[model samples]
Target chain A: MTKVSIHVTLKEGVLDPQGKAIENSLNTLGYDGVHDVRVGKLIEMFIDHDDVEAQVKVMCDKLLANPVIENFTYEIEEGVAQ
Target chain B: MTKVSIHVTLKEGVLDPQGKAIENSLNTLGYDGVHDVRVGKLIEMFIDHDDVEAQVKVMCDKLLANPVIENFTYEIEEGVAQ
Candidate 1:
């Protein structure tokens, strides 16, 4: 099996209310150094394939991430179930 | 400012319905190779401080992540706003 790690982030210029909320919360909690924050999703999947990277990309582009406001990147590592 | 990337994953033994759904969906989509999947959160923050790493950890423990069911890891990079 192949292990794929996908990182999805909001594209530049997209308004992220959640991020803003986090920033405000941090400040309220007295973490004064925090300037900004952006929240995203990380997806890890195990697959059996010869071209895991390409397949993972297809997964991301198709369903894992929203293409309009989000961008995704992935890393693949080879492994097999014991 | 320092850029911090925090990754939060569910602890072992915790049930992840979302991960299971994704796995089933992949199989239904004809990606038969998929065996298992786990979903997590990725948080990116910009902070201004000399101890960004430690502060980030505090943030994770206090609010960014739930320590009971989630484990978080972070990376810090140094930079300054132009």
Candidate 2:
């Protein structure tokens, strides 16, 4: 089974109020070197149904993401990265 | 200049603490039929430096992503997705 990984983030110059909150929280939590924190979304799905790669892409285009203020991309790992 | 859109999401069954929080918040916020809400990360970058696509994939591999418990994908729009 191929495990698909996807990340969604806002375009540059896009005002991110959510990110601002997260950054503030991080600071309060004492995280260092994180002068700038832009929070984004990360999705992972394991496919045992159809073509893993194709379906993953399709999901991204359809329900998995919004193409407006956000963007996404993914990869299938043989084992795992980390 | 080319804009790179990237999406990052949690791997299924990874026990997403952050997603859980968001889902709970969504429910509390009065969003209906949303029995499930999984929140992820989204990152969009504009490149005037080099090959936009190439740098995008690299960024995903390097600092832009964790590659574990997360997945990502993206596209290039001639204009914008509203």
Candidate 3:
């Protein structure tokens, strides 16, 4: 099996209320240097080895990420399943 | 400015309903080899450069992640702000 790690993030210009809230919370906690916090998704999965890249891309396009507002990038680690 | 990317994932043995749901969805969509799906958060932010690693660790401990059930790792890129 192979391991696929995908990062799905909001596109530029999209509003991220969650990130803003975190930033505010961090500042309130005295971590004042924090700014422009953007929150995204990290999905890791195990799959049988076969066209790993293409299969993962289709998975992202179909269900893992919403193309209208988010962008996704994935890295496949061959034979790294435990 | 420095760019920090943090990946927060559930600790092993923790129940991840979201990930299970995604896995089920993928199977229903005919991606049968997929399994062991885990969903986590990827947080990206910019910070003023000064003890970045320490500051980020504090932020993670204080607000960004819950150490009880999740584990987080971060990578720092220097001078990557736009």
CA RMSD of each candidate after superposition: 1.4, 10.2, 0.9
lDDT of 2 by residue, B1-82 (tens): 5444566666666777765664454445543223333566665444453355765566566555578876767776453333
Model 3, stretches more than 4 Å misplaced?
none
Candidate 3, B17: how far from true, in Å?
Answer: 0.4
Q: Candidate 2's residue-wise lDDT over A54-77, tens digit each? A: 655666676556788767777776
Best by TM-score: 3
| Every candidate's lDDT | 0.87, 0.56, 0.93
Consecutive 10-residue window with the lowest summed lDDT within model 2 chain A: A29-38
What are the per-residue Cα lDDT tens digits for candidate 1 across A1-82? Answer: 7778899999988998998999999999999888768889898878888888878888888888899999999987767462
Tens digit of per-residue lDDT, candidate 3, span B9-78: 9999999999999999999999999999999999999998579999989888988889999999999998
For each candidate, give its TM-score against the true structure: 0.94, 0.48, 0.97
Q: Which residue runs does candidate 1 get wrong by more than 4 Å?
A: A80-82, B80-82
DockQ, per model, reads: 0.84, 0.15, 0.86
Q: Report how closely model 3 matches the true complex, as a DockQ value.
A: 0.86
The predicted structure with the larger lDDT, 2 or 3, is: 3
Instruction: Classify candidate 1 by CAPRI docking class.
Output: high
Candidates sorted on DockQ, descending: 3, 1, 2
